[model samples]
Target: MMAYYARRKLPTSCLCRVSELRRQFTSASPLFFQGTSSVLSNRVPSSAPEGTRLTGCNVFKNKDEPLALADEEYPDWLWEILDPEAQQKKLDADPERKAKREWRARMRRKIKTDNFLKTMS
Candidate 1:
């Protein structure tokens, strides 16, 4: 006797559609509703607990003064890698910067970029 095979039908609804339906039905009541902030306040506590220090060193440790040479100092920072390229491209692409081409403007941009680069590391 020859064996016969049958293929199962694919689901009509996607995972997201099923999830949406489930969410709608489950949260139909006021207690479970997402928009009812007062009812849900007891279940969810906002903000970190007291005496919780933020991760990483504080940038304002040296008052409000910026670092003199951020690029030279912190070359490996994430902001340094991403920010400088974008800022350089913006400065290069701007028609006003090109037209002015003043040393002061270029210096200002460079300083700002370097200061940003130094801040994250």
Candidate 2:
């Protein structure tokens, strides 16, 4: 880990907070370098985005291109480590999306009928 940071020349302070990290947690975890005095606090990699490890050309700069989660992007690690029970609650509490889906389907049918009538007239 130190080797990677040294290669990148990042300091130990970069692992602090968002306002602090404003550009951290990119390619690797900052915790890995926190222990060693060899920590490097260099800015985020130039190859990556301003606040991320992925750069503009290499990454999606707009909604058309979304960043894929390293994991399920469901239960964050902090949630699992701090409150794992919350994960279970989410699965158990999927409330009924069926109602909303049905409403949307009905609205679509109405729209199609209205459009057809206007075309016929």
Candidate 3:
């Protein structure tokens, strides 16, 4: 019980100990009783509701910035731009990506040739 008080801080007028809240946070349920049964439970804090830090947390709460968030039409989310069939077509179009294919072939052949061999060795 003392350990729980250490982990949880609830904003309530009652003289509830920290341990009670800490026990609630660790509960597996998404919902829990916050205040004393008499005080009535309401309101979740706006800051870090996920119970984690906002910056450098690695958990991407906002999917926009990483995925073209600046533009609504080209948002970084793949689902926003292409449906399943379109994604498949994009994959199928790889063979027609001539410039890249030619570049790769050129690179492979050039690896054993003079221009690359002299520079590498």
Measured against the true structure, the TM-scores of the candidates, in listed sequence, are: 0.19, 0.27, 0.20
On a 0 to 100 scale, what is the lDDT of residue 84 in model 1?
Answer: 35
Worst 10 residues of 3 by lDDT: 38-47
Identify the superior model by TM-score, candidate 1 or candidate 3: 3
Query: What is the Cα-based lDDT of residue 100 in candidate 1?
Result: 78
Clashing pairs in 2: 10-40, 10-41, 10-42, 11-40, 11-41, 11-42, 49-54
Give the per-residue lDDT of model 1 (tens digit) for 7-87.
323233233434554454444444433332422332222122344442322345554433233222333322222233334
Candidate 2 Cα misplacement greater than 4 A, ranges: 1-52, 57-96
Compared with the true structure, what per-residue lDDT tens digits does model 3 show for residues 1-121?
4455335542232124233434434442333222222112332222223323323222245542221122223323322121233345555678667567678889888776967779887
True lDDT of residue 33, candidate 3? 28
Question: Candidate 3 at 102: error in angstroms?
Answer: 4.0
* lDDT, model 3, position 106: 93
Candidate 2 residue 47 Cα shift, in angstroms, is 16
lDDT of each: 0.41, 0.41, 0.38
Off by over 4 Å in 1: 1-52, 55-82, 98-101, 105-121
